[model samples]
Target: MNFKEHIRVIEDFPQQGIRFKDITTLLKNGQMYKAAIDELREKVKHLEIDLIAGPEARGFVVGAPLAYALDVGFIPIRKSGKLPGETIEADYNLEYGKDKLAMHKDAILPGQKVLIADDLLATGGTIQTSIDLIKQLGGEVIGSAFMIELMSLNGRDKLPSELEIITLMQY
Candidate 1:
């Protein structure tokens, strides 16, 4: 569907020499957003996913809808203290700085299959930390998905060698 056309790229955003690919352009267009989620659904439908987990903020936008389309429950992986119940957290580095993400202790059943989804895959720190939290809860990370991937960042290098990754577009 040529999803790239709907993305907005800004040069030197959030820092010098950094180009940020913003998905809000695509998100504002309902048709395009649905198409992207539908496409992602097609790509991961074959997997036996018990729940869709995503980090706070942008991840919620992409993950919730995809989870609905996939007919699975959505587990929010939020920043520390954002969740109400007892939660487990994993620290990670961001392109701009460092942060920690938390997930509810009871979010995943033991050995449940999970697929992590997010708006962007930049340094892999967020997803990697998410993987750590999920594993700590005894959930098996079946795969990870993203709306955009920055190839130059080599984010995939930080992830497990066997974990499957899917991205709708690359920059």
Candidate 2:
């Protein structure tokens, strides 16, 4: 569907020398957004996904809809202190420093299959940390899906070799 056309690339966004692929443009278009979720659902439907886990903010936009399409539960992975009740957190390295993501302790049942979803994969730190949280809960990370991938950053390299990674757009 030439999904790339729906994306808006902003140069030096949030910082200089960095190009950010913004999905808000695509998301605002109702038809395009549904098509994207359907496409992503098609890509991962065969994985027998038991749950869709997405990191905070943008992750919710992608994962929640995909989980609904797939008829599975959606787990929210948030910043530390964002979630109430018992939670487990994993620390990750950001471009400038370290940050932590937390998920409810009971978010995933033992040995259940999980698919990690997010808007962008830049350095793989966030997704990698997400994988740790899933594994710590005894959930198997079968794959990951993203709306965009910055290939030059080699974000996929940081992910486990056996994990199936899918992206709708790359730049």
Candidate 3:
């Protein structure tokens, strides 16, 4: 689908020497956005996923549509305190520092299979933490999907060897 053409690479965004691949350019185009989700959905459809778990805000953008397309529930893994009721949390390291993500204590049930989705995969900290949170609740992480992956960061290497990550484009 020539997905890379839809992406915009901004030099030194939010920091120096960082080339950020912005998906908003692609997201603004309905055809491109749908194509991305369709591709991601197709990749994960064969997996036994009872729910789609999206991390934070961007994840919602990608994961919600996938969950809808697959007729599965979408669970949002948000920043700490964003979700009401009892919650479980995981702390993960980022390039500069650390951050925490949380999910409702009951968001995932024992033995439930979850597919994690996000807009991009950089260092894999976010998705890895999402996997930990899901597993803490007894949910099995079956697979993961992303619209873009920053391969230079070697993010895929940080993920568990058993996981299959499907990305629409890489840079």
Query: Number of clashes in model 2?
Result: 0
Q: Write the per-residue lDDT of candidate 2 for residues 1-171, one digit (tens) a residue.
A: 999999998888778877778899999999999999999999999998999999998999999999999999999999999998799998998654589999999999999999999999989999999999999999999999999988988999989999999999888
| Model 3: per-residue Cα lDDT over 18-130, one tens digit each | 88888899999999899889988888899988999999989999999999999999999999989988999999986546889999998988999999999999999999999
Backbone collisions counted per model: 0, 0, 0
On residues 1-171, what C-alpha lDDT tens digit does candidate 1 reach at each position? 899999999999989988889899999999999999999999999999999998998999999999999999999999999999999988899988899999999999999999999999989999999999999999999999999999889998889998999999988
- What residue pairs are clashing in model 2? none
TM-score, candidate number 1: 0.98
- What candidate 1 gets wrong by more than 4 Å, as runs, is none
Model 1: residue 72 alpha-carbon error in angstroms: 0.4
The 10-residue segment with the lowest total lDDT in model 1: 88-97
Which runs in model 3 stand beyond 4 Å of their true positions?
none
Q: Estimate the lDDT of model 1.
A: 0.95
TM-scores of all models? 0.98, 0.97, 0.97
Judged by whole-model lDDT over C-alpha atoms, candidate 2 comes out at 0.94
